[model samples]
Target: MPCAAARACPSFLDKSIHPHVLRHSCAMSLLQAGIDTTVIALWLGHAGVRSTDAYVHADMTIKEKALALNTPVTAQPGHYQPTDKALAFLDRL
Candidate 1:
């Protein structure tokens, strides 16, 4: 009952892979390729996109990329201009 792929591939010979592993692979591939989680959820038959969050949180590269785009808070504090236009409107009140 073993699939040919499992036989020919030495890496898969000793280990057991669940059907969900394929689902996980497909989801992770889509995620790394910049596909949205909504699409991945639909592919996996997940009722909610929130279920795909596990993959998002599981991938550390995504976290690393997010950290790379962040500006460190180590810079000396300086006066910052308030960007909230609502403040200006409130001030005029």
Candidate 2:
């Protein structure tokens, strides 16, 4: 699915680009350029600098995190059993 941010900001993005990857790249590039988080936030149309703060304080551990992201993840498909509390809530709905 296209990101909601992409849908909301058609002018800022290429229609073919996925937002998370490109957005992460853009944020990292701005950080490397020494741009302030507040400015990045405004450029990305976020409501606050806090939304952009992740890139500002990122550490070398980011490489480790990126490596983790590149690894494949597998999960066995199975049915989910909702808790009794969830069932009760669904019944109420």
Against the hidden reference, what TM-scores do the models get? 0.67, 0.43
Residue range with the least summed lDDT across 10 consecutive positions in model 1: 71-80
Tens digit of per-residue lDDT, candidate 1, span 1-93: 667987788678788889979889989999988888899899888999999999999998887677666747785444456767978888999
Against the reference, the lDDT scores of all candidates come to 0.84, 0.75
Residue 80 shift from truth in candidate 2, angstroms: 48
Best by TM-score: 1
Tens digits of per-residue lDDT, candidate 2, 10-63, equal 664665656687888998898677677788899989998899867856745554
